[model samples]
Target chain A: MIAKVARYILFSLWTVALATFAQAADFSGKAAVDTRFFTEPPIFAQQKDGVAYPSVMIQPEFRHDWGSGNNRLTVIPFARYDSLDKHRTHWDVREFSWLHMQKNWDLLVGVGKVFWGTTESRQLVDIINQSDLIEKFSGEEKLGQPMMNLNLPTDYGHFSLFYLPYFRERTFPSSNGRFLFDPPVRNSEGKLDGFSHWQPSFAGRWSKTFGDWDVGVAHFWGVGREPRLVPSFGQGFTHPPTGLVPIYDLIHQTSIDVQGVLGNWIWKAEAITRSGQGDRFAAAVVGFEYTKYGVFGGSKDVGFLLEYLYDGRSSFAPPTPFNNDIFSGIRVVFNDPQNTEFLFTNTVDLNTHATILGFNASRRLGEKWKIELESRFFANISATKNPFAPPKEILTGMRNDDYIQLRVVRHF
Target chain B: MKLKSLICGVLLMAAFPALAQTDEEKGYAIQAEANRRDNGYIDSMHDAVMTLKNAQGEVSTREFVVKTLEVADDGDKEMGIFHSPADVKGTAVLTFSHGTKPDDQWIYLPSLKRVKRVATVNKSGPFVGSEFAFEDISSWELDKYRYRYLRDEEIDGNDCFVVENYPVYEYSGYTKQIEWLDKKMYQPRKIEFYDRKGALLKTLTFSDYNQYLDRYWRAGKLQMDNVQNGKSTELLRKNYRFKNNFSDRDFTENALKNVR
Candidate 1:
């Protein structure tokens, strides 16, 4: 798969280089080396990654604009090599898109990525691309989605329409990966019933700003990015299931996100209604971030974030730990030359008392170098004997996966 | 008795036009005339190279493009797109200033393709690790400051009218600014900033004036020196383009995400 992507990237780059002799173009990228140190040993024997994972990653970007700057082509390709887990080593084309700008509207074609939502805890309204879980368990990274989007600006607001012709499956950690499930998940046996990956999907969004508030309404109908895991028996087995088989379900989702700024306080909310594999469910996340500037008479800022997450789903729906949870975080900004920042977050499940704590900090070493530290800890996660039962506790699988990562990146 | 004498002086000075104007009124008139001369360019853009030098003599450079849409009744809308310091290559910021009110600002992170609203109360903090504070770089609206005439001074052989400006907005990093406005071009030749403690903090010097559309004058180079820290920043504005006919739509948060 990586060889094929490399070939495609080479071909695209050759074509772009040959056609842009009369215009201006530039190339830039970043390379990073990281090491992850797990605080606990592997719980399952299949987790062969051990307590340490070392990896190297690179992303190079090329951009060319011509015809009075109305047309542009951007290509960004990313690759990573992980020594601990082979499945974690992969390659992806993050963005290979062409943008055409006009007076009243603009159109973008090819593979691209888009993000939406206002809440900090969870992005309920963001469904354009599949999550790259193998890259980061926090689900902040995403794969580029093949799409054609048209954006229109009017007096009322901005409207965007998308025709996504290809669907990308969510990446998952293998059994040998550190953060694996009890029974592990098999991605090769994915079942797509109503549609194939080639089938097209549709999505639209309308966004506007009124005074201090920003609002967006969007709807998506297609193959769901998330898969419902179904237990599957081995070839010779009978009763006990061997592993979980991911089943892609067709879904329809409508969501809205809103954010308002009042002085030093920013209020954010995201709500979504989705239906597909199980009964229709509604989810919401509401939060506020307040910042205190010039802390202690110094050029520093301290911000506090508090959010509430709620999910209304039946027993047959996908298992989730955030059904009823509260998330709180503290952020500090040094406001210095390096733009140093630190953020610590905690999410607590109201019913089970399970908690997930995260810490992330980053600072620039110089003009082209940066260092980042990130860690996640799980606590009070109670394991259930029957993992396949209804209303399973999902957080138990990652109970012993607390890890700290240190990454040093160099940009060119 | 002071009030009676002042009233009599005012009434008598009305017959003599030169004696009728007070220091505050004269300062305001000079600034208003300068502001009127720079009012007609609908929009403008320029590329800037900012070099920052620390007290240890270590230097770093940053490059960005800035565009501004002039508003008649309110503050201007500004957008900045970073180019160099490769890590922040595609990052952009959109700002809508409302003079005395809190400005609306948003920053776009290209890696996540996210546009996040930022708090606007940090006016005293440095901008991008530069000696210039956020308040110093923002659009200079007339209502944002109250003016008082000081004394005349000559900077680089140019006769300049000295004036003191006190920030009208709350939470300012400076107690006051002393500006040496060039008498000929109606542009500032030098500015001295006083910290909140009423001590000298930073000094800004402007040179290389260029006129656009035969009316508006823009500074081609600016250098800010921090007296307390011995740090300084030099900003070189290049490739100035004016009258671009940009509208509010081009400066929106949505536009920031698509900046290349």
Candidate 2:
């Protein structure tokens, strides 16, 4: 195939070019096998869900320094194999970038991923990359974007500019995957496959730290990473929200993230205002984590997290399970050789009387191995008073994807 | 008038740098001299291997690289990037220590691909699951503690100045610390930390001292033993490169974000 030929040519050239700086180059990466088990059959009868499935991922990173340590190059290539969701099996150039440093300015170019936010429960302001939803249900995994970025550090603030040449589309779960609504909405990848998807976008952020407070203000003008749904009712999907189409639109968004620390408490706040999607709307998340270190004279620390999430549109906004919710969690860290940690979170819906419970536990083995256990539980979902649960909409379908996942990771 | 003038001159002579002073002042002067001797090595970078053992005698190892830059007017800036243990690889911590004030610290989580500012108030807490507290690894400043010259004793075949000091920083976990410094090089050989209840909590031993660049001294190995839990962590340092070109920018949050 032509795609194969192009990939071979590109990789060959990249390798030849890298051979020049091979002496100072470093190689690092991780390999992981993840297995997930569904607690029950998916709520959607139209799905071909598997009770248990496995996935494997390999990520390798290469780095080299040049220009007398003033310039650097980094490349990370990643691939994943899935047993159930074929769409989840994918390859990506996670990072292939060169950075040049100057006295007060820095420049970076190529494909990269950047996260911008100061919240734990949700990352409302982190909009650089589209969500890799099929790989992880948390929506935290992202696809790399091709960009040219510049940064300036000053006495007042650190300013950054980004020019993204292409937009990456968000991946969705396959019908074979466990998580879905009564009927999964189709993701139209061909809608903007041509030059329409290559629209250039620009974004900028200014961040400053004063005393105990770290603040950032950002503006993004581009195709929204978050999708807007449009009604396409004639599809074969039988669910009410099922006929919806995921459409990305050009939008303007401004955001602010603030973090303040005092004693044992860290306070985080992130707010975003956006337009040109459906209607101009705002959303915010504020939280605080108070940690008690050396608990009871032991070598462990326990952190208590409390966060409140808000969506200005309330009932009219997109169906996010977290809207008008209060999140409470506890993090326990064991300062042992195993580097063990555990987190348990409970999200209480203020209006819908629903609860989303999540837990993650991780531990490191001798040297190169890590074991992680994670689970998500959707409980007490009466959805009777849910504003977004109008008739047969998809917002009332959180009970379908409760899963427990286990993973073993090996690093080289 | 002559008697008064003579008395005033004698008092001024007593206040001179080389004149007689109290034990407290002598202790401070000694610390200042040691600090002065260790000053002006612009920056340093080193690879480190940390070995940890539990009460059951099980052992584990971690690898990291530490880069530090010396600051003339304030505390030094240091950064540590973890390389091994799989789960925490690529995780980095940046610290900006202050003389007598609380340090500013941030940790970069590779999985999140984000940097989070951390409160350094819990200086006594373990660092990266290691037995070493953040306070233990921070830069040593002359004015961070109040010292007393306990006595001069022989330790490991070397004459050592045994000093007891209490941390001036309010959030420090130790009530006091007893340190044994070799008289010749003024290098710390051993230190014992006391808990808030004044009970012995742990003992730190430093050995295999290596002199780099002819003027700078670094302990090649440091061991911390916790008496309560019967756990210990041993750090072995190697490949020390000093006076490398490093700027203050190298230790800032910006560097943490950009560091490969």
Candidate 3:
């Protein structure tokens, strides 16, 4: 059924392209190369620790405008490789099926990746299936694949639907005979044996602009294949004879966004609620960001944001403790498009006391090429022992990591 | 015969004040005359060039040629021009202007040999490289900006009408402007611009006014200085053809990309 739908979509897009080609002429192309280096050490075990690894990504995009109306065909081919992170080395292609834009209506159908995370605190609905870079670095064969996305606009608001047909499984090795499920067990291949069903997702977003205020509400739902649930002892209740069991069901998520700018102040806030399958566990998060332009000079802009996330249900065993995280960050951007560039961004996690700082400086060498230097710092300052540590020994130490990289990009 | 000659001489003396009165009237009469003169001067102008200077001292000039055609009751108006210097020459058409706020624009690139329409709400935004915006150059008649007589002034030995013009358009980038209009010729001699924050932004001076067709006045040179940026632009008009045999059909979207 999914394949049939994909074929139909491709057919329709081809028809539109042919029709546009018959009426109009258009030419646009852009080529870019981006390279990045990580400062922080690997957060997960079983991954190679790297000090100076470089990655480069190149993407060339092209578009043809058909004069018959506001319709266009766009294709982007991307290639990337990283010596430090081998899993990120891959080739990808994106096709924008048909973009029909009118005065009041906007419709897009395509097979590619779409980013929909609009909030800083609760990035819950950003479920686009991406390659597991961490796993890939460990010599895994799996890679990221394209997904189908559709967006429709209406008078009330917009609606988006996404689907990823293939599902990949993951496993971890532990001390107690390579624990697979909860409580210590022999490691085994996590497979989608009977569940060959494609991962179907849906999101409905509605927004209205009133004067200067924009209010929005969104909801998302997806099927959960593997669910790990641990059993625990409650007040006046004894543990079941059976060991910790796994519970699996579908996941339902909802969120609301409200943003407005008044005078010199910009305010944005988002709240997200998620319900885990089987168990009625929920998580809520809220955040706000403010931006001011031309603070010092006409070329500078500054932004600050504060966010808080409350995990009502913890993933740890037995205790099911609640966790709260607070985050604050500041960003300064210099918008001198002609020459001399400076961009600095710093984000601090107040709860765990973790912070990430980034700095980027670039200068235009000529019309087509530029040289840039960048540095990133990641630090964790939690007082409590590392949660990932074994229960036998108490853990205490701050994790510190930093990286600096330089890149030269030529554009055509 | 002596009594008849004395009566005629008295009538001639009474009518002399109406004919040879001082051009500069003070109190209420001065204000009324200035208003009438300013309106007539503004109504007579059909088109002109607007030049802008940016912070980096870069200069960009745009031509605003307006044509007035007779409509049933109200006059029908149209404007044309190219956006960029590179896009101005042969087989390229990137000129976009509309009569209303939130303008509609079209661009014709010779490379693609096609015209693209741009429909954006913020047409009052700054032009390509200059601080002047499309709203500053488009067909905005004198009636669009409310005027108030500030005081009588003299520019270059010419008595002028110094008036303040406040824009009536919504979301205007300027608060007000002071203009010096030549009293005798009714041509703008100088203008002082104030930003939305009511701070001085720029000053424009017009010179070398030549009478076109004996009845119309056109400025041959214009200079605008950005007070905040310390940059200025000097524009010299050339090859100006007024009331040419151009038709509305020539300015349509289809012809925009093919215009030479």
Candidate 4:
């Protein structure tokens, strides 16, 4: 069967390669090794701190086009192996999609990906697809989503209309997985409030770029990407795992993003207001980056970044540490033969005084491999004072989860 | 020379109120004439292989393709997609350069699978770990610098006109640049860049010129040597195609992210 499938794929590709003006489809992917060291021991029930072991991932992609660059088909598959945490060992079809292009218009169908946002810290305005939470904590990884998108071009901007037929639940770690709740977070099933499984969601955005300004405003009306968990008491048992249930809420969100560039200065702003997720509330992130090239007359660059983040519902908001905070970061780039860079960031909570600092340094190795060193540390984290800690938030008890990570990626 | 000067005199007289007539203005006129002679190609696309060597003679190479569309009033729109050197094979960069304004750039990372809008602040930094700066690989706009004609000289048995240009844009790492334009072809044969300290830092050489449409000239090879670091980079051109009918839509961030 494997041989037959391989032969079939080769035959199809061979036939398409004969088409007129036909450029061969792109075939590419990567192999990666990711691991983490938990510094301290596990403080929670199922937490095993030390080293989480090495997890290996192999991903492959195939993208093909036909008929005057209008029709296209893409397929990507990912698989990983993990020694520890069963949740970390997984597989996914990141995208298997089709695209059709027309004059000043385009159509996208099947399982694809769409991202919308301008902020570096968080993408609050991107709500079409569910997050692949088990992948990482940075929220940069996403799962494939099924949708039919209609895009129209205008003189001033672009308008995108979306139709998402089904909702996807966020992935989570199992009871044996590392960095999870005491009794595990996943229940037997998902329960969404005021929405059904077959409900079709709708979303749209209008984006354009002026001489110095790039701006976009988007609106989403459907199931919320985030959830509110209702923990069912586990009889207060000491060991045997039992209960936590996630409740999905239907919501309507409207957002806007603006970015302006001037020589060495870049300013950005993202604001959002959402309804149906408790009460109507708003949030905003405003920031700017300034950089100096050839610092000290050398071929090095240093960029300073400052951002202010605020959420209307301070205490009542979700268990995130960024309700009212100041974020500052520094980026150093070595424009050398090795292509090395370092980034350091600090986010400080105004009300709770909880501070988190993250640092990442990356460099190219040889020609194919890239190595990244990352460290995240939390300071002044008080369970009573921290909104992101304990019974209020899933990670409240995980205040001590701060650790260092090293990952190596090889692109083929 | 008499007829050409008479025509130039008549033209300058009709436009006397707009520009000051001086040596600086004469330098600008010379450069503008060369620029206008190279205009109206519509668009172009090409492939390049870049090789770099260090002071110790260690060598590495990268492969990429570029699509550039010339705009009438503004600077050009360019997109570059890497093809080889596995670590950054699928990385792509889109740039929109304006005359005297800062450029807008976006980078697409295949790993994180997204497009990142990069703040174009360190344009003088190296390109792809090579000796060429980011601005060196971009389209040349006439308004970016102030020009002054130095003199005429002979290089490689060919008569050349020398001109010195000082960058007026902010955040540039170079203090000034001197260019040698071949008299017959009006093509840049060599360029010398001075550091911020007014010291000669690097020199660029262009050779193996090929003319498309029998009018526009393009170099098949470009080499930059960093005198300070004793390192060098060479760009060898492979294919050059013109008039591809590219539009603004092809250079947008959306198009950049979706390029397979």
Q: Give the best candidate by TM-score.
A: 1
Interface RMSD of candidate number 1: 1.1
User: Could you say which candidate leads in lDDT?
Assistant: 1
- Full-model lDDT, candidate 2: 0.82
**Which residue ranges in model 4 land beyond 4 Å of their true spot?**
A1-23, A49-52, A181-184, A194-196, A236-242, A313-318, A384-390, B1-26
lDDT of 1 by residue, A1-412 (tens): 9999999999999988767732566788899999999999776777874677889999988888888889988889999999877778999999999999988999999999999988898867899989898998767799999999999998899999999999888888887887766567788888786788898889999999887899999999998887887778775454556677778878899999999898889999999999986899999999999999878557778999999999997665555678999999999988777879999999999998899999999998889999999999999988757644522667666889999999999999
Scored on chain A only, each candidate's TM-score is 0.94, 0.90, 0.65, 0.88
Error of 3 at B157 (Å): 17
- Using lDDT as the yardstick, the better of models 1 and 2 is 1
Candidate 4, DockQ to 2 decimals? 0.51
Instruction: Put down candidate 4 lDDT per residue, A199-289, tens digits, no spaces.
Output: 7889999988886788889999988877765555455544343545667877789999888877777888899998876678999999988
- Evaluate residue B11 in candidate 3 and report its C-alpha lDDT on the 0 to 100 scale: 82
For each candidate, what TM-score against the reference? 0.94, 0.91, 0.56, 0.89
Residue A204, model 3: lDDT of 59
Better of 3 and 4 by lDDT: 4
* Leading candidate by DockQ: 2
Task: Residues A106-132, candidate 2: write the lDDT tens digits.
Answer: 999999888899988887999888888
- Taking the tens digit of each residue's C-alpha lDDT, what string does model 2 give over B1-260? 99999998898877885455666776776777789879989999999999888899988888899999998889998999988776677899988888787788889988778989898888888876777888898989988999887778999898988888889986788999998988888889999999888999889999999988887889999999989789899999999998778886677776787665
Q: Please state the error at residue A165 of candidate 2 in Å.
A: 0.8
Q: Candidate 3 vs candidate 4: which has greater DockQ?
A: 4
Worst 10 residues of 2 chain A by lDDT: A384-393
Model 2: CA > 4 A from native: A1-24, A189-195, A235-242, A314-318, A382-394, B1-20, B212-214
